[model samples]
Target: MNPVIHFEMPYEDRERMAAFYRSAFGWQTQMLGPEMGNYVLATTTETETGDRGPTQPGAINGGFYGKHPDWPAQHPSVVIGVDDIRAAMEKVSASGGQVLGEPMEIPGVGHYVSFMDPEGNRVSMLQPLPRG
Candidate 1:
């Protein structure tokens, strides 16, 4: 079965949010620069390559994004991993979901796109790059 691999939440003050998570939950945070949309990567578990996913089973890691005024359904969202993103997009559409926009590359990650499910909940899908 496809997995819920990653998650995202909106943040206004990057530093404050990072500090709160770090202090309260002991989660590590890496703040990405402006070119990467000032995204904050939260590492909840140890990693070999420092990617987002947790190294241990039964655990999941997520990230934080700066809030955008124009974005709709800007609430917390979970990202599901898919083998074929294009085909998944078609299936989502066929199943009464709306693909938000064209897929975008996430550098070392993979192609990703957000969508609204039939119940109107916003979620994302990612096609992870093959590991070498």
Candidate 2:
């Protein structure tokens, strides 16, 4: 089965959100600049290689993105890791889910895309670059 590898949530104030998570949960937050869309990466647990991901199995990392008025369904969502993005997109479409748009490559991360499930929940999928 495909596994959830990450999560995402929209935030109106990136600094406030990061501070809250850091203070309450001891999560490490790294704020990316505008070139990267001002995303905030949250490391919830010890990672294998600094920013690679959680070392503990089943424990995932996540990020917070600035909420945009034009974005649809900006809610908390999990990202599923898939081997082949195109195949996954087709599968999602065949299963009655709507793939929002073409997949986009995240520099040093991987190919990512969002979709709306049948239940109207927005989720994402990622095809990660092979770990070195």
Cα lDDT tens digits for candidate 1, 88-129:
999999999999999999999899999999998999999999
For model 2, residues 1-132, the per-residue Cα lDDT tens digits are 899999999999888999999999999999999988999999998998636678898999999999999999999999999999999999999999999999999999999999999999999999999887
Q: RMSD of each candidate? A: 1.3, 0.8
**Global CA lDDT of candidate 1, please?**
0.92
Each candidate structure's TM-score, on Cα atoms with residue i matched to residue i, is 0.95, 0.97
| Runs off by more than 4 Å, candidate 2 | none
**Can you tell me which runs of candidate 1 are displaced by over 4 Å?**
50-52
Model 1 misses residue 69 by how many Å?
0.7
The collision pairs in model 1 are none
Worst 10 residues of 1 by lDDT: 46-55
Give me the displacement of residue 125 in model 2, in angstroms.
0.3
lDDT of 1 at 95: 93
Which TM-score value belongs to model 2?
A: 0.97
